[model samples]
Target: MDTDLLRTFLEVNKTRHFGRAATNLYLTQSAVSFRIRQLEIKLRTPVFTRKRGNLRLTSAGEKFVPYAENILQTWGRARQDVALTDSYQQQLTVGATSLIWEINNTNEWLEQVEAIQPEWALRTESLNRQQIPSALLEKQVDIVLTSEPPKLADLQQVRLTNFVVVLVSNEPEQNMNTIIGLPLVYLDWGTRFAVEHSRIPALQRAPILHSHGCQPALKFLINRGGVGFLPLSIAQPWIDSCKLYFVKNSPIIQNELFMVWLSSNEKYEDISVLIDVFSETQNTC
Candidate 1:
């Protein structure tokens, strides 16, 4: 069985649109369709209903969902086991939204953890904002650092930090109108930020550039000269270096983050150390 075909099926199932799944998987729509057809031929049953522009799972497909997920999980664990080092006694699988990755310096933190706890092997994953919650519920990752916490009762969410997000731009002097009219790179902060942004009349128009994460927005701001909001901890270092400037009178937004783990996890002490690491990392910014 081809794992790629299984992956394509899962992506299509999640999005319910072949084109959108292709975009998410970085494949052409035709390629995704081909993979699905191949999978159907292999399974000898149609998994999806293709009718009147509707994309839906058949009854068999619904049942196969768990099987597909299990196959992927088992394969993943096998790969990890194959690659395990003898020096590491424990493994920590972690994931983070891209914005959280930037704010917390998560990759560097993993390096620090590896240095301090050589007995533990830490793996980090970068996930889309929408994917984090479900991934946490599935125990696909041991811990997730995200902008918003999951609502699942099976997971434990710890409030990690409340940080300021300030509007930043290449220019120093700014007015409300100018800042609004300027080519903007809007980062999707969260629901509360979305509500507040919608109330601002000038922001109703779509931005010149929009990203779900801060890194791409920040990159565009640096290279192409646009205004966008960034964590103060991220923008502060750049501001001090004169690489970026804070927009005067621009709205400052606050975003809260949480670390989510399975409540059933018995490694309370280990999880606590990770939480402390995430909390104390702000001082390094």
Candidate 2:
């Protein structure tokens, strides 16, 4: 089946109205209806119920959603794989959360991979924690770097390293009470950090600055002179430069980071080699 037909079906399914979907897809309403009719004819089943002002999917249509999505995803991955030039032996796509990229020196890791495996092409994507699991499962990414591993039977997780999040501020001489008086910049490390963070009453309150990852929180601390918890790896540079100071009395939370990929991946051995490079780099870091 043409992927365009699947695209039209999904768009109409999303909008639930042929006219709206047509407008969004930059096609005429009649064209959208034609595509849906073609899809139904191919499937030999009615995918949508034609009711005036009550557009909805038929039972089969609901079931077809995931299949259509999977087909498109597989098609996209295939395109990427086939697009590689003659110089490349294979492509490895690595997806990581922004914080993971920053703290783990992921760019350097990729550089190392390229140096050792000069024939391989490397691709990196910055994804959030929420998007990692589905990206891995759908073969959208070859590997994912994250702190919390998604609990899925088909995915394999490997521990990269453990990191400590320490409370740091510009004012090193300030005690806990004085530090608490300063604005707190909260960075969402992960579930484990949240659990450990709740134990500290001073860090429990609403933050003056909030971010999903380290860079924003780190920037806020440097520019605005607020206190926040950051991975030691990320905070070390500024701490060394006397830009940020460790809050000695604050609780330190340790979290393990992991890289995950599909267990059934075709390039399992090749992926393992890339991971070995990362592990070796981490050991030296």
Candidate 3:
């Protein structure tokens, strides 16, 4: 079976919409439909029951999920193993959310890996929340760093570090009450931030702006004048330079960073060394 077909099947299962799956795969909708048809022909079973606006997997389709995932993973590992050069003993691929990359100094960590382990080949990918779990399960990534960890039976989740976020404003002299009344730039920190934010009566209203990444929110807050929660590490320089200030008496939110990988990975010992290197770098910083 063609891996493209399996990828298309998984994408369709993920989005539940043929058009959306096509858009994600950069294929035409007709192409997606045709692939599904070909897959059904090969399987001799209709994997999905297609209603006008509702698409659902058949029992057979649900059963096929694990097999498809396993096939892809095995293929990926085989490809990586075959591609290894004499110069490199092992290849490691790491994926993380954009936020984790920024806050955790992921680039520096990667550089450190190169300095210490020149024989190890490294690949880095930017992953979203939806892709993190599947990426690991499929062997598309060897490890994933994320703020919102995935709860999968096949993965091991390790608490890496805690990051501090504080509500900061461009207006230094503004009181917390006054700052809350101004336009708000809401940054999606993670699940914990969401829960704590809901409990705050002052922030109950809709934000003037919302951003997934910290830099845009921080830029907006600095230029446009608003309050937003920013990672202390990134916001420290701005705070010191008088471009931003901590909102007086505001709640401090600390979020956890996690590193996750397949529990059954044959490279558990080697991967643990890389994890230790990361932790040491964080500690020294």
Summarize candidate 1's per-residue lDDT along 1-285 as a digit string, tens digits. Answer: 899999999999999999999999999999999999999999999999988689999998998886897688657856885688787767787888777787754555567668777788776777777777766765668888776776777777666557778888877776567776678788887777788677666556778887877778878888888777788877887889887898776677767666788877655568777666666544333
Write one digit per residue (lDDT tens) for candidate 3, span 78-190: 78777989998988888988877888456666776788789898877776778787888767788888878888898876666677888889987776678758888888866
Stretches of candidate 3 exceeding 4 Å from the true structure: 1-84, 275-285
TM-score of each: 0.70, 0.69, 0.68
For each of the candidates, the C-alpha root-mean-square deviation to the true structure, in angstroms, is 5.7, 5.8, 5.4
Using TM-score as the measure, the top candidate is 1
lDDT of 2 by residue, 1-285 (tens): 999999999999999999999999999999999999999999999999999999999999999997897788678767878998899989888888888887755555677678989999877777778877888876778888788888888888777667778889988776567776889898887787778888887776889987987788988899988788888888999999999998867777877767788878887898877666556433323
Displacement of residue 50 (Cα, Å) in model 3 is 24
C-alpha lDDT of all candidate models, in order:
0.78, 0.83, 0.83
What are the clash counts of all predictions, listed in order?
Answer: 0, 0, 0
Distance from true location, Cα of 252 in model 2, Å: 2.6
**Residue ranges of candidate 1 with Cα displaced over 4 Å:** 4-38, 45-74, 199-202, 236-243, 266-269, 272-284
Please report, as a residue range, the 10-residue window in candidate 3 with the lowest summed lDDT: 276-285
